[model samples]
Target: MNPAERLLEVGRYEEAERSVRESLAAYPSDAALLALLASILRARHDYPAALAAASAAVAANPRRSAGHVERAESLILLIRSREAVDAATTAVTLDPSWPGGHLVLARALVAARSLPAARDAARQGLSLAPRSVAVLLTVADVERAAGHREAALEAVQAALALDPGNAYGRWLLAMLDAERLRVRKSMRALREVARDRPAAPDIIAMTWPIRGVLSGLRRGLAVGAVAVCFLLAVGHWWWPQVDTFARYVSAVLAAVMIGFAARVLVPAGRLPWRCLRLLPRLMRSASVASLVLVIVAVGALIAFASSGWWVLAVVALGAVPVLWALGLVEMVGAGLDDPGMRPALLGLAGELREWWRTTKRELREAWTADGRRGE
Candidate 1:
């Protein structure tokens, strides 16, 4: 094996970097060496240097997909999603049969929040290489972001089946089940991941209660907020009949409630722009019956407040509990399908199976190589 390849395989990335650098100096126009350097830089998390190395490789050999894929990953790390997508697209266009390009494109599109497109690209990669752990994880992430939690869980389960020690896939399953409020599944997956990567950044930074498991408090809080909004609608409708001050309070409450709902639903901060674009579509992915219930509750509040339909207001508030129940039922139903424990157990089993097979294969190959050399 080449010095860089040997060092990289042994996880001595710094040594690999030095070896690649030395080789690149000797063969300045060697695109493969540049690609190796790009990979080394990426492994070291030196994204800017990785991007430069990858770009050099692409410039040296535009026909190769590896350089473009490396460039796309570096671009993604640099938060240049559009450029990453373009680079990845170029890679796949150059070699449609290569799963690498499709994988990169899928990931870049996911980062760009073009979820449907990301899912499509991921599916394309999977169609090309169904056993690819990378593509499976990408598809899982895409499905999760698209609110297809069951599908996402299934993808992670499949990936774990291929290579059981994939922390990223485990992390994904934990987070997905967590979001869907599957307490036992979330905790099981979360504990397994924490065992492997105790201080994983995402886990450390996670604000989710119970270490990424959805606590009762979180669900109750969301439910309470929605219920309060329905109550506000009632006030806005009936308070005018009571007094001037009461009516004024109702208006302020209604405005505040609206703002709160928007903030909670759309989410804000780092990806506010992208969230704004995706929120409507994501909202539509929610339980249809539950959504209708909430809508009817809100509409009834409006009717009572508008047409002085006091009776309708009572009916709307009465239905709030039922609507809330239905939403919870829908969420729980989704969670039941994504039982985290089963997937985690499968992953563990797969890891053991893979280890056993790999050890036996390596022993067999070594024995054969020795016999050949002796002969």
Candidate 2:
């Protein structure tokens, strides 16, 4: 069992499958083996085969809750939520004291968008296994989807308290904070989680949004600069009032960029040299260039507001095009405003990367062993 588990853990699916087949040849009707094989098939993403394996396990021993749980898991993987709920319910009835059954039920309910039922099922599971991070996360997901944001926050906080090193827990906490408009706290929490798991699973892939925040803002500023260029050109001679308002708005924009850049370049409680050293090198040169452009833009805006000379700001706008061409201060990434497919792809990619690493390690070990001479 340990060998099979290790094989599965390290993505040696073919060997794991072979091991299971050899074992089943000796114990053809073993329900546990059938259930284990179902799980192995699931890991290999052979969902239909996994379903068949799980069904065989259930048929082999109707009294065993493990078979039912395995069946439920396979059904959920196939997106057969209703069937999964039935299978999970059977597991719960067969073994009313176990958390596995309720966890499956909760997961199926979440897929079905039956938030109330999922929350209840998760709570039932938590009552049985009070410290299960998976069950707790499910509860929090249900609460969040049901518009109980604060409850979701509380649940995740409890999960973090239980396992502070859980990357998913920290990511979820950070997302909840982000949702509530606590940007600084969310940024800090997200950064901490990202630092811990550079290739985070799809379940907590905040890297794109978090890492691209400054870039996105800069991109936005570039676009705003273009728009302001147009507005200044049109409003300079035709609309005195328009030019006056554009000046104040441009000044505000310059102030905002300068302020945010300062925050990023210089955080409090550090010596000036250390803070400068810690600043992201990617943006350092761009930040200096942008500050200079901002100063020029501010000066132009004031001149335009005072004497209808808004055309001067247009020269400052040329810097944006240069930066954009250099690929320095530009918008990039799907960002936090994504329509929501990136996280799944990232998760899949992360799993595949791990599988590749495990396979490499196993091959290396086997090659070294083959080179050893027998004593």
In order, candidate lDDTs are: 0.68, 0.69
TM per prediction: 0.58, 0.53
Clashing pairs in model 2, backbone N/Cα/C closer than 3 A = 202-347
What digit string (tens of lDDT, one per residue) describes model 1 on residues 101-138? 88889989987999989999989999999988988998
Number of clashes in every candidate structure?
1, 1
Query: Which candidate comes out best when scored by TM-score?
Result: 1
List model 2 lDDT by residue over 190-211, tens digit each. Answer: 6676567655333223332322
> What local lDDT does model 2 show for residue 280?
42
After aligning candidate 2 to the native by TM-score, how far in Å is the CA of 25 from where it should be?
Answer: 2.7
The number of the candidate with the highest lDDT is 2
- The C-alpha stretches of model 2 lying farther than 4 A from their native spots are 6-15, 184-204, 207-375
Please report the TM-score between candidate 2 and the true structure. 0.53
